[model samples]
Target: MLMAHPAVLRDLVEQYETLSALHAEDGSPESQQRLNDVAYTLCVSTGTRDVDAALIAARHHLPGARVEDDSVLDEEDTPKPPAATSAGAGI
Candidate 1:
């Protein structure tokens, strides 16, 4: 299961809607299609079928809107500790 903070989900939905509205008003079919693609991706990624519910939950958590950097930790940053073995054990 993909777990996402409520706020993140809301931001995506808001962006999707805004893009969709812009597409409709300007008769930009290509932009509208892109927005639809984004919406679909958000839904699938969040494991949510109800886009409205996801949007509401997201808005409640993230009102001001912000972007977060998701970077992977380096191997050096995650050094493994040495393992201990029995001093007197039959091999």
Candidate 2:
């Protein structure tokens, strides 16, 4: 998989976090689901199996942005969760 620029990743993370927080609060289920989907997409875009590599990529592209170890991508080889029944339902 082609890696996205760090800036892109940073933006994605920001958007994901913002949307997620909103989703947790008053956002519609559809909006929350969309945010989750974006985060999942960003995680999968980095082909590296190493979570650190993916995090580094994100940091590289976004200088001054802190990419925490916790932001590492999930196990790429593992099966993804079942599809959501509706927006935000699967997440």
Candidate 3:
């Protein structure tokens, strides 16, 4: 089996955690089961047999890897303030 890219593995791990937290908050039974099925399949189909193993392998392979947080996306969506105009400065 081809080794999974460190970035892809990291994305899956982060997604899984996000889904898990969502499920914990307002999860339905069916949604939980479905999430479990898809999550396990994702782990196995990648290089690792399970989620824990995948996480470990990813960390081992890429020590400096970082999982981007949602705050980055959120901040990008905010509108930037208009630049201040100077009376003497040229446009």
Candidate 3, poorest ten consecutive residues by summed lDDT: 65-74
| Global fold similarity of model 1 (TM-score) | 0.45
What are the runs in model 2 whose C-alpha is more than 4 Å off? 24-26, 48-57, 65-91
User: Model 3: residues >4 Å from true position, as ranges?
Assistant: 24-26, 63-91
- TM-score of each prediction: 0.45, 0.47, 0.47
Q: Show the lowest summed lDDT stretch of 10 residues, model 1.
A: 65-74
Worst lDDT run of 10 residues, candidate 2, spans 65-74
Q: For model 3, how does the per-residue alpha-carbon lDDT over 3-85 read when each residue is reduced to its tens digit?
A: 56767666666767777778733688777776676577556746667766655655555547455322223476755778887
lDDT of each: 0.61, 0.61, 0.62
For residue 30, give model 1's deviation from the true position in Å.
0.9
Model 2 residue 81 CA deviation (Å) reads 39
Residue-level lDDT tens digits of model 2 in 1-91: 5667776788776776677667643677788678657656656756544434654555555677554433444577445668757777658
Estimate candidate 1's alpha-carbon lDDT, on a 0 to 1 scale.
0.61
Question: Candidate 3 local accuracy as lDDT?
Answer: 0.62
Which one is best on lDDT? 3
